[model samples]
Target: MIRGIRGATTVTNNDAAEIVNATEELLWEMIRANDVKASDVVSVLISVTDDLTAAFPAQALRRIEGWTYVPVMCMREIPVPGSLPRCIRVMMTAETPKAQEEVVHIYLRNAVQLRPDLSLTRKSEL
Candidate 1:
């Protein structure tokens, strides 16, 4: 079986270090929540808001131990008026035994507002 795990997070600014740090954090959380192993991952597609240009979020995935062979790609999210800014979104497809409903989607930081229903944290807490 195969499933897709969605995750998104935001960085406070456009700093390269901040983007890398935030992306890595989000990836780790998603992995932990779903118990996903790098070996099982098929590919990861990442999109970032136009506002974030300091770095490629894929850098974080490349840094993960044992993830060297995983395919990853990054691109800009479609810019819509009043849409969230400085956000990084990821769709990770992997071979897993879990059902679609069993996969946990993660939304963190300011990006939580993008999908309040899937977010574990309340808006007030962000």
Candidate 2:
């Protein structure tokens, strides 16, 4: 069965290094929470708030040892009024046996405010 794992994180600034580091951290957390393997990932879709323009978050996936062939795309999130800033969101599709509810959605850094209910397992508390 195919499953979609959701995750989001925020960077302190629009620096390329910050974006890449935060994205990598979030992706790793998502993978660990869902027990997902790079080979099992069908694709990864990432969206960053308009305020972030230093780098494409997809670059983070390429840094993963076994994710060279994993398809990933990145784009800008719609600039909703009063919405979160410097945020990056991800939707990872993969083949997994776990049910939807069993999948853990990760929210890290300032992005935790984006989904308070799921913030129980925030990176800082993990």
Candidate 3:
């Protein structure tokens, strides 16, 4: 069996380093919460707000983790009026023996405002 874990996070600015850092933080949390390993990850799909083209969050993840061979794709998040800016979101599908209810999803930083109850864990598990 397998499950999908969706996580979202936002940066306060468009700086490349900041975007990478924030994205790294969010991704690490998601990976940790679900106990995901390189081999367990089926694929990682990432999207970023229109205002944040400083770098691709997916590339950032690959660079930091040295997951050069992982399947990673990046797209721009639709720009909607009054939407959160400088945001990076991910939909990760992994090969797991657990059900959806057993997988931990993460939503962090200002994105936490989207799901207060599901916003985080003391584990920084996002």
Candidate 4:
């Protein structure tokens, strides 16, 4: 089946370093949680909050082992009032045997508030 793993994290600043590091952390946690292999991943879609214009979240994938060939798309999220700032969100589509309910969604930092129900794990608590 084709499954989607979701992850989101808030960067401490607008710097490219912060964005890349936080995104890498988030993706690592998500991959570990889902027991996902790079070969199983079909594509990755990344979205950043309007306030986060320093870097593309997908750029972090370049540093990740075995993910060089995976396709990635990046976009800017809509800025709604009271929305979280410096937030980066990712949706990874992959072929896996796990069911929807068994899939793990990750949320870290201030982005945890964005999906309390869907986010079963937090990096800070790990």
Candidate 4 residues 33-115, lDDT tens each?
88899999999999999988888889998899999999999999898988888899999999989999888899888888988
Better of 1 and 2 by TM-score: 2
**Candidate 1 lDDT by residue in tens digits, 24-94:** 99999889888899999999999999999999999999889999999999999999999988999999999
Positional deviation of residue 17's Cα in model 2 after best superposition, in angstroms: 0.3
Steric overlap count per candidate: 0, 0, 0, 0
> Which model, 2 or 3, shows the larger lDDT?
2
- What C-alpha lDDT values do all the predictions have? 0.91, 0.91, 0.80, 0.90
For candidate 1, give the lDDT of residue 91. 99
On a 0 to 1 TM-score scale, where does candidate 4 land against the true structure? 0.93
lDDT of 3 by residue, 25-48 (tens): 888888788878877777889999
Which residue pairs clash within candidate 2?
A: none
Q: Least accurate stretch of 10 residues (summed lDDT) in model 2?
A: 117-126
Output the lDDT of residue 12, model 3. 82
Which portions of model 4 show Cα errors greater than 4 Å? 120-126
Least accurate stretch of 10 residues (summed lDDT) in model 3?
117-126
Better candidate number, 2 or 4, judged by TM-score = 2
lDDT of 4 at 61: 89
